[model samples]
Target chain A: MKPFSTMKLAVAFGTAALAALLTAPANAAIVLGGDNGWEVSYGGFINLFFTQSDFDSQVPACAGPTCSEDSTHMQEGLLPAFHTLTAKSPEIGGLKGTAQITFAPDSSGSKAQRLNKGGAMIDMREVFFNVSGDFGTISAGRTLALFQRQAILKDMTLFGVGALVGPDGGGTSLGRIGFGYVYPDFRTRFTYKTNDINGFNLEVGLFDPQETTGTAAEETDTPQFQTEMTYTTGFEGGSFNAWAGFLWQELEVQASTGGATGDIESFGWNVGVDVKMGGFNVVGSYYDGQALGTLLFPNVAQSYACDAFNCEEAENDGFYVQGTYTFNGKTKLGVSYGESNQDGTATGAPESDNSLWTVGVYHDINSWLKVVAEYDHQDSETLGNEADIFGVGGFILW
Target chain B: MFSKINIVRFLLALLVTASWSPLARADEDIWKSGLNLYVRLTEQDDAASGRPVPNQHPVNLDPAAIANSLIDIQVWDKHWFKKDEIEEVFSPEQARLLGQQLAIALRKASPGQDIVFAVSRTDTKFLGFRDLSYTAGRAFYSNDRLNIIIGDFMRPPDKFQERATSSAGVMEIKYYFRHGRRDDPSDFESAVMTGDGVEVYNEGGKRRLDWLVIDVNRASAARLAEEKAGEEANAPVSDEALRQEAARFAQERREMRLEMARMRKEVGSGQTGAESTAPIESRLKTLDELRQKKLISDEEYERKRQDILNDL
Candidate 1:
């Protein structure tokens, strides 16, 4: 109740501020402490969804081929809605400040929080502050990495399934971090854009280990550092976009069980190309990371295999090509086919190959609203065969 | 086998026969009218048949000097004609024979007035078979406009009923001069003093209007005035500089008056009708005779040719 009331107040304030901003002249002086100086923006979406899949059941070591479409259940529920209130400060000495507090209500009770269960939830997301200027931008808060900016920036609709899953297994992931991966630290990074030397742009980022925990002065047993460099090239034809990025991290952590004391070096590299030609847009990516040293194996056990010699390196490489041809800007038909292969070099374990295919139609009700219905099928040779899922959802943003 | 002398004589006779044919036709006479008009629809060399370049000025209007009146109608297996020979020189009767047939053929082949037709033609000093040909004829009514043709009827429509001539001259309505003189010291000084009391400069009698004489070749009352003017102007321009200028002008003007006094007199007098046509027609037959007869030469002929090409 308290949240709802605060949201209503925010909506009123934001509406008034927007009206003032729209009416003000570009060079007009704003009243510092009044509605003229303060801006609030409110946005939210509600979803009613039903999902029916065929292979929702769990099987143990089934020798025969199983249909992914079976063992599916149909459910209907009112998913929790997401809303945000953003406040921007009046320009002070050519420096402006922006702070946003977002609220995504969780309606999917405890069952929603459990593993491998279908329930509706809000998965409260993103609260951050940003300041930008001639000398690049410094965001002393949480944010999606620069690598992920293209996806969120280009996503037009407030409601619809995205091209990739969000970290919370909702929303769209546009060629960014995968679902279930979150950067839980306040990352401070500086980026220097090298001059466009021959159509190539180089950007490098360094994330400090202490920015997130508010324990900069405290000392610990092990220190970790993560650094990444990305190089991008623009095509002269204006249709194709490509980027290659490499990430390296050094972590000092105790062994999971005992007193193991060695520096662990992890590395991940990805190269991606996106092409938008007439009537079709296709994207493909290849990712490889240090397998045995950092990445967890695909076993049901909570403990990692102990033997470095016997353990297979964490090698998961997957590529997907999705094409969507817009009949009009508002209506599109999309088809995607992807296959991911993960092989562990350990004995007695088979190589795991996962394949996923999807076909969907998306309709934009308007700029801020859209509806997407998709049928997705996945086959995991390592995870007991297959899974089929069908979902329809939409969102709104203003 | 035939003797060498007889073979030589036979070959010479054939050469003489070819030479005689075009000169005989040239004696028939050619006349020019007034101002050559051209409205170019395409940048095509063979405007009638060549492909048109895209998105350009689809229409052009130009006024050109008429070069000849001979309309070369090719007859096969009769003579070994030079590649430059474009039109057949014919007497009025001979011309009427071919012209009428062509007119009828033209009317049947092209029904619209938009077909290409010549407005004027020209010829030069020595002529056998002219490397170039000319045909002029266009008609204008109260409701219609002027149509001038120079070459092949590359235009899509319009066909005319008559022939073309080079002596065609045009009347100037008004002339425009830029306010400033060309950026040269001599030209600037001369331009400063050319004006009368008024600010405007007058250029009424700068050039010899002798083209007017060639345009109307008929012995009308107007020809008497032109003859008198010609005699006074031709009063032996003795200054070397002026004489050189006059020669240049004469060389340019000669194509329009192909049968000027000398050539006309050679054919028009001192011989019977059949023999009279032989001089001009004989020279018309071969490129060698063109230089040998001094009608046009290795130097002047080449200069004239290059000039016409440069004009093109």
Candidate 2:
């Protein structure tokens, strides 16, 4: 099928490229003791996938009319190769502090380019410090946003490839981003997380806002406000996690050419649940919002779709359901289906829809290594295109 | 309408309420008192020195060695106390009975092995019954010494009118063991009644003491001789045979080491994937099925098929 628009694809890839690197399991760190009770840890993983996709219609990657319908390449999957360093200070006055930094590099360039220089560049994704005590934790700096954080973390495709952006795309793949939920891209923020109370905890943060319209003179009088509430508990035979998150931001926009002057208020809410029983895991999530855009918050293209004189808010909603069963505690087989839709505004534009089906098998060779095989079928009603993608990869962590 | 000012006020109120909630108290309050017993068995004489190994000081016991030779380790927590507080919880009568049962089980399990039992108690507050005094008793066994250390809080001794803390009680028990052994069973009986800090007992003295007799000669001479003969028969004979046996032993050791390394990695990293013998074949079969169903073009299928074969 025809691929997503250039702006949408860019937003999706940019969001995933920055945030997906930090999705590696945190417990696999190699810790080293330092003087005065300071400890340092190194962790992260490298994964590469050989992917092939067959499309039903021409995509951006096709520059000629006689271009082939299939494209094959070796690239990073949903997650790029990550290298992280963390430093933790001993508890002082009942408060402990920690600082972490991470670098993510992709492997998606051509052979000739690789010979001349590096295959791809690196993205500094996480640089944050946290102070925690009986009062809970306060974090400041750049990190993954809280909205839809749990939904993406619980996604089975986090460990495998879900959807391909394009034939020659770099960075990371979109692991059910638009199909299942909006991407909670990483951003600089100040957040406070309360200590867990009977398995219930809350997180509230003020994030740096993004420009909705690239061509407009936009002003944000207040930071984007976000909050998430999560509850986790374990029963006799299994455990489950449930969460709800909310987002709100208001932007005063005036066209650079002095044609439009109005306010666009964006608001979104999402709820999700993950249940793990024995070796079986099931996940379901849904999100709804107005002027929230799809794929990423305040999508620039969607904002442009609005009338310049009087902006009419566009409504978006999506849901995803996934189930996975781990066999013999080592091999996991999963199936996921999700769809995202954006309804036309008052101007009466045709609504657009994106949906995908993913089936994957993840096998652990050992604690530090895993092999993954995935197949994805993606469809776009707006573009009237369909694509089938197959990928195989493995991950290695320190 | 959900206004920004209203939303901000609501979130602030929620945060304030959550922070002041009683359930948000320090997590350390979750700690509770319990009884733990560890038992290990080793040769009375040191293998390298060929001399009697000194008894391990209760606090200086090597946990790794104990784990390697462990006969048993039992923990009696609140869950067990809930079921049978009188019999399972730590008390003078219960401790004595537990000591008796453990001595019997170990003697039966390993005949002719020297046994030692050491017990120490720490006073603590128990959950749900904070008004009632509680003691966390830790007991270890090695060599031939059987020492039982009771907390003064259980039934405060007349000498220490004030309830003794855990540290003071531990020190008092250590002093009794260092002074000398009180091998007589009557010594323990009297100490228990008088709320003494320590009660010492040994396997020496009359075998029929306290209505318990451990007959070490359960295995007859005929059975012992047969076992000796089987051990000798398995011994290597010629030099060539000995060399072969040595090589086989080395190979087995290497395999064991590799398996242990793999297990350690798995435990450290987390869960691992299951073993699959023919991943390539399975992948090929899947690709063929997709092609048959026309999900992929013939050209695409051939290219993927070639790629899989190239890995071979």
Candidate 3:
């Protein structure tokens, strides 16, 4: 259904209909359901932030079974500014829509650079409609993949660590405009919300990379998929929330002779808690997953866990501690420290561990506006390392 | 005589409430949102034409109020007796000045509340079992007699007070007059009152009259009042003040009559032990006490008291 168009029609006709019903005399015989209904509200927020990071060339890198130090391969700090716009529709028929567009400036800053920037100036961050009721909510269109669900809850911030992860790996932003569907995945979902069971709630969704417009080579163009499940509940004033999920990807690597490639699957699970006491909140979680076979870079001859279907795997595990305090009814200060260890069959990739620490402050300008500034730093102890980023962004919506 | 005691108790409640009752004038019961104030009239202690309630007796306040921090009851004030002096002796202008002074004190005691006496005439309370009174009397007392001896003199002549200690004097005042009766107490109290007449007086002044029509709903009252006016029963209700007053009276009368019918229907309902908000017997006893004490107009007492019980 064209939800947007349908919403427009409902809004157009709802005004006169409401007036007529309210003005009508009251009678027990007539059911006055929609007369008391209200129209939806609309608002949105956008945030743009500039980040500059300098990498030290002294970081050590070793290769082969022995230690062989590499020369200083470093460049000056790079400055990148990313801007995103998020818009939301007022809730109608228990459904609301959201869309986000991200833009980044190109170097050679002026008009000449824009001409040769190769359409890289803009990106679709998130665009989807969420339909929900007492039964359950569904989101169809391009949105966060399943792998991001658990992390999304843990990260708390929409534009944080969880959003960057592709669910299986620690942080991999994959596939623009992925198709996401949340079915009553019994394992990961609450099937009885409509029936009113209060103790537990669960949900599961799968994100597939199949384009909106079908392509002839379906197998070749079909994007990798991820599935996730989450459960949440509250007991005796404390809440318990948990989630787990997996991702599968296909990489048709360049063949040594004939072109041939295989797909790979990676799975992970996350468990976390939000313990609240007085005004202080403490969060803790443990996540472990494996990235096996040739998931990223393909090995053509390796029979690697080969069945008629081809797939590889890798393993990773991480945990984090985050806390936030709210006061003055407007601003909140938060800090989190996390570490993850990534290990795989690939060489020079020895149990690579990464640590992330972030401190941020968020000020709610008003009910519909908020300003956020956060400093995030990551230290990777492996080959493809030397990567650190700082992000400060803000969002608004109504 | 038994009924007279209840009346005295009822009036004493009124007297005590009048002289020292925390029922009103102190601006003590300040309420915040989300908190409900439920009133249950336990019993009446004393009833008389004029009684001096000196110091307010301290009682064990509701513990729930502390946690809720939102609900409370200003049951009794020690200065209630002294406070009533202003109402009894001061002229309108004087009363206004006194009201202003008390208002300041009230503001100091309970901020955010307009410091004004809780109007006694319009507000109703169950003085005892089957006894109800709408009379006004001085109800205040100091926290201490400054030298009064601790004795049984404090206890009110009621089931709950009988079992309570003399220190319960303040409690008796608080429970019987100031606060509503408690749901549970340490006694097998017979919530009954036997009395002769009821009294009615239009102490009606400038105050918000919360007219409760026992059994009449809003629609029915409007319909009845309209029909009486010889207007189309379904005519749109005018927003005029006079029409609103008529509609209000119609509702109140309907409620009174409906309450009476409901009592008749429940005559053999076999329900016992504080079924009504206030016992009908209590109202009867209070009237008897008032008549014996000559504290109220006999005709008014008889007429209004019966008006109350006839509903039962």
Q: Is candidate 1 or candidate 2 better by lDDT?
A: 2
| DockQ of all predictions against the true structure, Cα-based | 0.01, 0.04, 0.01
lDDT of 2 by residue, A1-398 (tens): 12455644654574455344222212324346635777887767788999888867535465564444687878777777777777877776677777778777775654334421243446777788777777777777777788887777677888788876556566688888888888887778777787767667788887887776554477765668788887675432356788888888777666533355566778888999988776688999999887766677766446334454665667788999999998865788999999988898664434768899999999876445689999999886544457899999888865
Most TM-score-accurate candidate: 2
lDDT by residue for model 3 (B172-220), tens: 1112122211111111111111101111111234111111001112222
TM-score of 1: 0.41
* Runs off by more than 4 Å, candidate 2: A1-33, A58-68, A110-121, A213-216, A256-258, A348-350, A381-384, B9-312
lDDT of each: 0.35, 0.57, 0.34
Kindly report the fnat of each predicted structure, to 2 decimals. Answer: 0.00, 0.04, 0.00
TM-score of every prediction relative to native: 0.41, 0.56, 0.38
Q: A150-192 in candidate 1: lDDT tens per residue?
A: 2222222112232222112322221112211111122333333
> Poorest 10 consecutive residues of model 1 chain A by lDDT?
A174-183
